[model samples]
Target chain A: MTDASNYSLLLDEIAAELDIPPSKYAQAVQRYTSVGEWLCGDDNSDCMDDPDVYPQGSFRLGTIVRPLKDGKESDYDIDLVFEIKKEKYATTSKEIKERVGTRLNNHGTYRRLLKPEGRRCWTLEYSETDDVGFHLDILPAIPKTPRTGAIHITHRSGNGTYEWSTSNPKGYAQWFEAKNITAFITLEKTQKNMLFESNRELFSSVDDVPNQLIKTPLQRTIQILKRHRDQRFANHPSHSSKPISMIITTLAAQLYSNETTTFEALKNIVFKLDAHANLQQHDFILEKSLADQKLILRTPDDKWIIPNPVAPEENFADRWHENNHERAKMFFQWVKWVREDLVDILAKRSVAQLTESIEPFFGERAVKMASSRLPFLTAPGIITLIPTNTPHIEITNPPKPWSK
Target chain B: MKEIVERHFQELVSEFKYLSLVHEEPEIFSIQGNIEFTSSYSEEIIHDSYNITIFIPSDYPNSPPCAQETGGRIHPSFHTHNEGTLCLASNIETVRIFDENRTLMHFVKALLIPYLHQHSYYEKYGKMPFGELSHGAKGIVEYYGEYFNTSNPIITLLLLKIIAEDNYRGHSICPCGSGKKIRICHGEKLLALKKLKPNSFFVYEYAECVFDGLESDSIPTELKSNYIYKKISNKNVWQHRSTTHSPTK
Candidate 1:
């Protein structure tokens, strides 16, 4: 019975039927933003003067496919890169990659990611049918200060997590960027033509053209966001802690060599996400319904995917940042409640409370997905509050043992 | 709690305790709840013609409270409008600004009685409920309005929104150089394509959304904002005490 335009009737009815708490939605948004910020490297972007490059969207928005015939599944491959520009992170391409590998480890069941393997990096891909698949890719650039001929995105590895042969791939990407050129050349030992370029000119396949060269960071971000919303997510679970909003803001904040940022910049990005129109027009009203859970929309049989909804508060990431601890606590309190309820629901269906069990709810066709998760369970940069034996503050029944 | 609900709760707890490699549960922040509605009314109350359940987490200060409907009730809005998910904006907007330092007990109490009873149609045509608190407006309808569509296959539509949002919210940075908001910059176009091609699938979904968003020409150079470049950087916030210690320079 909302007085709003009723622009999305479907969303209204669903919310009426499900009736999730307001706090749950806020917490979900907060969690999504937290994951996104870490992935992108900045948790705030609402105050950005210009938000297009750093503008907002949802985790699912990261996965819209290209307009082409074959580019349906993976039009863009983007990962949440945290402190990626830090010298400590980029110190050695190998070290940066190894760190990413450790951060990305998820019980080791899906495709493996070798931070910056020889030519490409591999990570886990969740599949409803296949259960799991190998997602191998490489970043656009790597640490090349001292190393040459490093590695590419997709590198098969018998080596360690994200470990590449001593060869450096950063040299090539950097070389291409500096020269603003592209080339299709066999990777010395491999005969495969690895298209290298700063611009789109170097694409070899008719499909690889990137549609355009030097896509605005916003443009590039759009593709990344679209990917998360596409039908493929229904097909599998990437299970990343990285949320699309955070990643977009981070890229926007760091689009240039010297871009400095604040929380407002990130919030601007969230607003952009709210304006999207992939879902049924009626669903527009329920934009926040999608906030609570890490979602993937699947038809009854789990094949087709409806369009994704965007977050309305994308332009408001900074307002929350003024009080990070407070915001986190608020977000987590609701999530824990929801998690308890969801655990009950999943238990009835015989699903576990751990991540693996959370799938049925996300994958369900009646997919009104919200979760009550342990907030600090697997965040990339969040510091787990562990108390030492100093006894500085008396501890009465300490909380349950912390998550690993 | 009834046996079934308790069983369900136990099942969920079990999953949290056992998530494997593929499926992972969200991290739990804290657990606490209030009997505000139940204590005040001593029973479930229907406001705006919907039954609601209120629940809180253990980490009351660190986490926000949650309330959801337990009984099944079909909502009216599902028949119209294409934005299928619930439009729970104000409610989310309210609690989204929660401060752990502030006692949320009052805020939590507001959600059930006066909040739900007050001007109800916040999402409807031209009705604006004045205040930062959306105790009932958010959870009452917005949550499902987007995902549950009576006109189309529910799952297909949900998938589209999830994928699209995932793409937008999942990334660490925008691929585009402009600083404008992504939704205004490229959101409509991506969703438009998704609506246009329901059966169509993608290899990397967001990548496709962007390619199509850009190919369709929604991205304009003028869309870039002067504030964008500055916003994404990890710079100091105005009046933040952390500025003294952050020393980005």
Candidate 2:
């Protein structure tokens, strides 16, 4: 759990420097929504909408990103929840442990600290002071469930505001087919003190996200801005990579804190470092549907997710749509030398030079040519889809259904 | 059934005519009688040291035993990251002794029995094996004067991990077994010892791991007449598992 007061102090300091009201914390909520919505409806096929994600026990399905109490000013962990749902769940813990142990025994390392306990819970860790090795854990949590076998999820507004919802996933799926408001739910009673259910959604964990929606991407344009922003900041001085701590600090200080994140800014960042980042990922999937095409966008159960554009009908395998005249050979080398110092700076700044300042470097060949070659981007098949029903209209391949 | 393994183990130890080594390293003497089998491990663990802890599940033979490790003290590989528990291939619990046609006598004599004196750090106050620098632990054979014999650390971190993981799926093997794998013999006591000093790698006395069944003739007092066979038994599954020889506190 994080000490909110401690973070409020840090946020207060930043606010003083920016001359923004402390209540501006409200804006973060909007940014989060934008990130989520953008991911759900991006051009990349990796963004997925999964009705199939369900918790077996006391586990919840989203990521918990918050400040840490370690006081190092930058230490934190991304905690996730998962538990077994069957009568044999207890036995599952031991089995899960053995599965991991078997792999370690085969891999072999130099030294270590930590061993499995008898009854429940197992962790694998390493420390230079006490021990030196990487650690992983399989913790057991006893979930609180209703005897009647129904599930409930709750939401909180800023300060005293609050909202709650009850759901029977089995029934929700049947109904989701008839409605399209975007179903949300939670399988865990609590996620960092903010209770999550199987239906209600909250991106920043802060309440009242719908009203404060500017920081969020109201449309698709923000996605492109964010990609470009990410690429421009990929390389900056002061970036370190030996121990993981430095990279983590850089991430929190330079990336997650940014409220001005845009889709294009992000695309430029991703395009340079890893052009194939979400190449194999899909947007969504249509399961057991009457539609002739079952292809639905696929989403992953990971921390970061986003939407990508389908290739324009005019452009196929040719990524050289706009820059056919420019030599692509030298461009690839420049991207290979990326670092995260720029990301650190971007994490705090509201605008990026990639879209405004750096766009001119590529000239006319950069902006307009990309669409001339490729029609639609194809997501990989790494995700699983169990869709009930989602809206879909056939793409006639004209300006590539994306424009229409 | 590690028991079939136990039988072949029994025959292997019987072949060393208790008195034969008398002609070799005279400091060690024996009047060959029944040799005990102790300690066995899965081949999956590919770490620094060969030492392992195999857990014997309740349903023996039919159900495969689980292999685990501890201390992360040593490893032939970096399998166990920290908590020093490595798990090996599982669900294979049939009596499997290396060579089928070999008699227990030939097995023990030909394969084990030599491990008893493999490197007895017991002679020293647990300091013979190592220093704090070379390897994290103490009390092991100084292989090459710098590292423990099996790289100076008798138990590698990887082997420890494999054994620790084994406990999850199988039973722990007490190092004090007569000569059997901890799984088939006195495994409960070993499990109890888990919490004592799990992460304290250097504190565990390697000498204690040596199963000293018969009294050392050098100690005198209780050999039928004075010519008691002082044989340091080779490592056989039964001998490693035997609870008959109590561990000296």
Candidate 3:
């Protein structure tokens, strides 16, 4: 077929490789549910009255990617909100944090799996021996009054002092869902039908298949962007200042306009975000549009604001103005990188060229996976023509030497 | 310092299994190793390996380490300095890359591995993989000329002067004779280069460029009045007098 189609197919394959496998997804759900039941189970004396446990973050959003730690593929971090029905002001942050810790400590299995207390959540590490291992970060939270689906989770500063931090994962998810509605509506039936057909033994009908398993182009695009961000900052000193998954997801969701393909969605999102980041270089129309929407705001004093859609007070870019806007600078640099690595490279290059171009950013395994699946689409001869050691063109901005 | 060096060495050795620590002193740490790479795409096996020694100074993360070809496979013609250290990249480039990923593993993977691969590719093909640059001062001028997107060395030097002084006036006249403002011309590039390092670094680079121009007799007549030329001329005078007064001669 054409090179554009090949690029799209290659992206789809790479994103698929990065995605959480169905078996792992099921295991995550089962494990988190069991942990939830154990917390509110009758055996525990200090169990909460009405404890609600559910997956949040990427897991709930269906944008999970196999995380890389120390440059190696590590466990999936499944964040679960172990929220309770208690009044927010009735208890202290320390008490809620301790209550969850104590309950998990009460269980022999959970206590063994439980890591040292995190700043906010209690981590349960599932070893790789358990098959496609994952970690569940159970956030102990109490409901925030007058704000629907918002909860005040505990935060522990470096000085070992605890404070209440407000988050609305549920509300954020709803906002994301609203943005993804058009694409979701278009793809839901077919995805559920496919799911039911594949797992005939588990589901009685297509309707019985859970909605979480259905992924739209928007979800897949977020997954790819997150993986790119992770790889870009893998070993860099700017790792701490790298663009966070929340901002990536939020921007992707906002820019996503029911693109039918993952490649289209990702390209548009990166292009638009790059334009938004470097507004002065772009056209006045885009600047006016951004100003009208106020999605990404730049104040007169050079402060940046990327507000949380659900909680307007919680700026995703709160730290962007700090350290001479290092976070903001790095975010734009990353966008430039994504633009180069993903969009520019994939424009009209051959399958082999595209694979080689993306290998450094997406890693060899994903590239190999994409390459292996390419012969069916393109001629085998084209695939065999992959160069062993192609020379790079002379770089435009070459580095200066010491003596010379 | 020793502990930090040891830790970085350990990290480097962990990822690169063939590399091992050879020598360790308070100020210097060395590792001798062989790196191997085989292409994943080719069914017909192609493997390249190189034996090398890496010398990391105590003040690393600020300064870059040096690598030498212990196997003598790579000739000096292939970008090795007269002292036999592999010219993997420009010092400032190394600092920039290392700053981005301040890990020994990244140093080896990003810089050393590519250098070796380029050398090996050159050996097999009888040409450099990525085109080569002139050895000493001329290469630096060529690099900056490309960096500022100006073929004229004079414009490049002016941009370097701006960077060295850290005085970027966006609304000032463009140095490229474009008759536009600096911001409309090359202001963004200047700002980017400025952010890469401090003004002091660019000051040294500017002096080096001037010295290079003088040595090659390539300095245009207009630059005779430039401040960099005056600074170098003063230093040259002091050096000439000091050498003339040496009694050992």
Model 3's DockQ score = 0.05
Per-residue alpha-carbon lDDT of model 2 for A33-134, expressed as tens digits? 332243234232321322022222101111111121221111112111122232323333344334323433433331133354423323333332322112
Candidate 1 shows a clash count of 274
Name the candidate that leads on DockQ: 3
lDDT of each: 0.29, 0.25, 0.74
* Candidate 1 structure quality by residue, lDDT tens digits, B1-249: 133233434443231222111112242322211111212122223223223333434444344445432212223332111322222223222343333122333333343233332223332333323222112312222222332322222222233334333344423222233445546544453444444322223212222222232223332333222232233233343224223322122
What lDDT score goes with residue A399 in model 3?
Answer: 34
Candidate 2 CAPRI category: incorrect
Which window of 10 residues has the lowest lDDT sum in candidate 1 chain A?
A: A395-404
Kindly report which residue stretches of model 2 are placed more than 4 angstroms away from their true locations once superposed. A1-213, A217-312, A316-341, A344-404, B1-249
* Candidate 3 error regions (>4 Å): A42-47, A128-131, A198-205, A279-286, A378-404, B1-249
Interface RMSD of each: 18.0, 33.2, 14.4
Worst 10 residues of 1 chain B by lDDT: B31-40
lDDT (tens digit, per residue) of candidate 3 on A45-98: 443877788889988988888888888778989999998778866788998899
TM-score attained by model 3: 0.58
Model 2 preserves the real interface contacts to a fraction of: 0.00
TM-score of chain B of 3: 0.79
